[model samples]
Target: MGRIVALDFGMKRTGMAHTDEMQLIASGLTTVATPELIPFLVDYLKTETVDVLVVGEPKQMDNSASESEELIQAFLKKLKAACPDLNVARQDERFTSKLAVQSMVASGMKKKKRQDKALVDEISAVLILQAYLDRKPFI
Candidate 1:
């Protein structure tokens, strides 16, 4: 009924993506500075109808929590406190950045664009949301 938002939380910049109101397609939104992420989300939610949030959880190749997990956990806590009625979920984000680069290369994106970290982050958010949408069980 409402849009599903996904976030690729990074230390420097955070990426965002969202689904249509019907939750059919996942599209890249934008990358925001890490410090401005919460404010940006708060502002966006004020104007949009978000049913659920899918945040990318960084993990190591050995399935262990990455060093950034603590930061992400803190952010999650902040988000939960800020939006108690919102449903928030996490999706494994291993290799998402690598996959984004590979996808960009395969798609023949220009070198300048492919090198843009913001674009990579946005694409990573899209990938994370698509994975969540593909795997979530909707009743």
Candidate 2:
């Protein structure tokens, strides 16, 4: 079986996570610069087996798409162009960063460590993937 991958894409950095072949648990993978994300994903895909690409779809409190939606859409288009065979999906990414910060605090992570934006990004990616996993059963 192939694994499911998730992405928390940002303007400056992009975070990634993936599930095991059984798709049981999701874990943080890495953070890459925004400009390098496609290349990074391509290289990773060349070596690993990925089934689905779950991207975080940011939305506002009123349920409308966030300003970043345009960027995400463009990125998604580029990603599809680069990997036509891959299946791409989207999951609601509301309050993921806030939840990531709370999780770090609850886990007793150091202040310095919690201040690392890349770390937060990675954790957010994990949350995005976990949400997908949780909803997979109903869908």
Question: So what's the TM-score on candidate 2?
Answer: 0.97
lDDT of each: 0.94, 0.95
For residues 17-105, what per-residue lDDT tens digits would candidate 2 score against the true structure? Answer: 99998889999999999999999989989998998999999999999999999999999899989999999999999999999999999
Q: Any idea what lDDT model 2 has?
A: 0.95
- Listed per candidate, the RMSD to the true structure in angstroms reads 1.0, 1.2
Off by over 4 Å in 2: none
Clashing pairs counted in every model: 0, 0
Weakest ten-residue segment in model 1 by summed lDDT: 77-86
TM-score attained by model 1: 0.96
